[model samples]
Target: MPFQGRVVDIAVDEVDLGAAGVVRREYTNHPGSVIVVALDDDGNVLLLRQYRHPVGAFLWELPAGLLDIDGEDPHIAAARELAEEADVRAARWDVLVDLLPSPGGSNEATRVFLARDLTPVPEPERHTREAEEADMVAVPVPLEEAAALALAGHLHNGPTVSGILAAVIGRANSWRTLRPVTSPWEYRRN
Candidate 1:
């Protein structure tokens, strides 16, 4: 069987699809791209609280954007978004996870990255059409606390929460491989 879909309508930001044997038309959106869940040296997760016009509410989310073009790699876009949104640059980067914001209707994919050894960079001039004049604070929360907040539904942003979870688990697994050190009392015992 071949999977086929037809575009019923096209717009600047979204498209409606009518697939074979499907009852309702599915909405496919070009959300561009995003990068989220960056960590600083102190094991703190960074987040941004910004207002979204579509939702008519201020939402806390990880830094992310749609791809400027089709051929652009998601990793590069992630790095750029991290710098732009948070004004921080990372010396090390790893892809923690890739997420589909809404699998049922939209094609929006969010790439979460674990960034370390961060250094402050000058803020880039805003190019977005939306007004972003409010102070954008880079609040650092402890990894464990952040995870708890996410679990309790206080942190509603999916990508941001997922990124933090991935980083915490990855760091724990990495630490498990290290050799244990002898205590000072052990030397006296010998």
Candidate 2:
């Protein structure tokens, strides 16, 4: 079935669940995505303010990009997004969180990475900013402050809020809970 309001294919499937009989699941087919919490040596996180039309206002978010490039590793995608969107490179990267953004509706899986050891790159090497990103602004917010704002209902972006909270708690736990950048991403395996 074709549902053509977006670039990706959207379809409905009838799935059997044993004694549960069959149910229809309608969802948007999506390639996975990656979010980068570019953490600076000063304990600040890179924040991007970009206009999200659906949200009706500019919202705060971390550097992130879709993992749509065929055959690109998630880590490599994250690295590219960091450089392209923020004009920075990270020497250290670790998986902060793996997400199923809307389990009931879509198979969109996202991985959030904690990026450290930042170094600025030359403008020529950056991705040409287009659309919303052309007027977007990047700001460095202290981690704790970002967490505080998130808790206070100011930071509303889902991935950004989740990433900030995870980073704060992960730090308190000595980041023992974070997985390696190369760790298996189950959803992506499909």
Candidate 3:
């Protein structure tokens, strides 16, 4: 490991290709993450405006967090993030899409979940906020409007954009295209 941080690490590797020869590659070693798209019966999706220091801006994003705990299920992690970040709990969850945000530079595998039948998390049960999370505010936007914001470039977060689009497609398909919440994660396995 070239560098290691609390949540991520940097690594350099050598790869051998029979015809192309050997090459050296440097990438971020990630533990994967989960994003939640919480949709209510009123067609509104729960969102968060949180400060992303790396980007130096408060961006509209879905409730998301790293899969940091060893042996923890991604579905459970998603549920935890939703309540922690959005102060809500989802009664139903389905895998919306899997993403390789920056496959060329990092092995960050992200799973976006479509959450429905939502309910507010009791005040005492909500997660304590810290750092940037302390300033986050949960906002609900209509599904179509959120998509427009994404296309208009007002919302630039990758996973949020992808999750919104995927949710739209899933809704159009009557959610039949959504994978089960317990679906095996393929990217992390390798």
Please list the C-alpha lDDT of all candidates, in the order they appear. 0.64, 0.89, 0.93
lDDT for model 1, please. 0.64
The residue ranges of model 2 lying beyond 4 angstroms of the native Cα positions read 4-7
Tens-digit lDDT track for model 3 on 1-190?
9899999899999999879999999999999999999999999988899998998988899999999999989999999999999999999989999999999999999999999999999988888999999988899999999999999999998999999999999899998989998888778743
Which one wins on lDDT? 3
**Candidate 2 has which clashing residue pairs, if any?**
none
User: TM-scores of all models?
Assistant: 0.72, 0.94, 0.97
Clashing pairs in 1: 32-66, 32-67, 33-65, 33-66, 33-67, 34-64, 34-65
Candidate 1, residues 1-190, lDDT tens digits: the string is 1233342222233234555443544555444355666788788888888887766777777677666545666666777777777777788766676667665766566656667789877545543333652555567888888888889888777777777777778788983422211112111101
Query: lDDT for model 3, on a 0 to 1 scale?
Result: 0.93
What number of backbone clashes does candidate 2 have, counting pairs of residues 3 or more apart or in separate chains? 0
Minimal lDDT window, size 10, model 1: 181-190
State the lDDT at 154 in candidate 1.
84
Sorted by lDDT (best first), the order is 3, 2, 1
Once model 3 is optimally superposed onto the true structure by TM-score, how far is the C-alpha of residue 116 displaced, in angstroms? 0.8
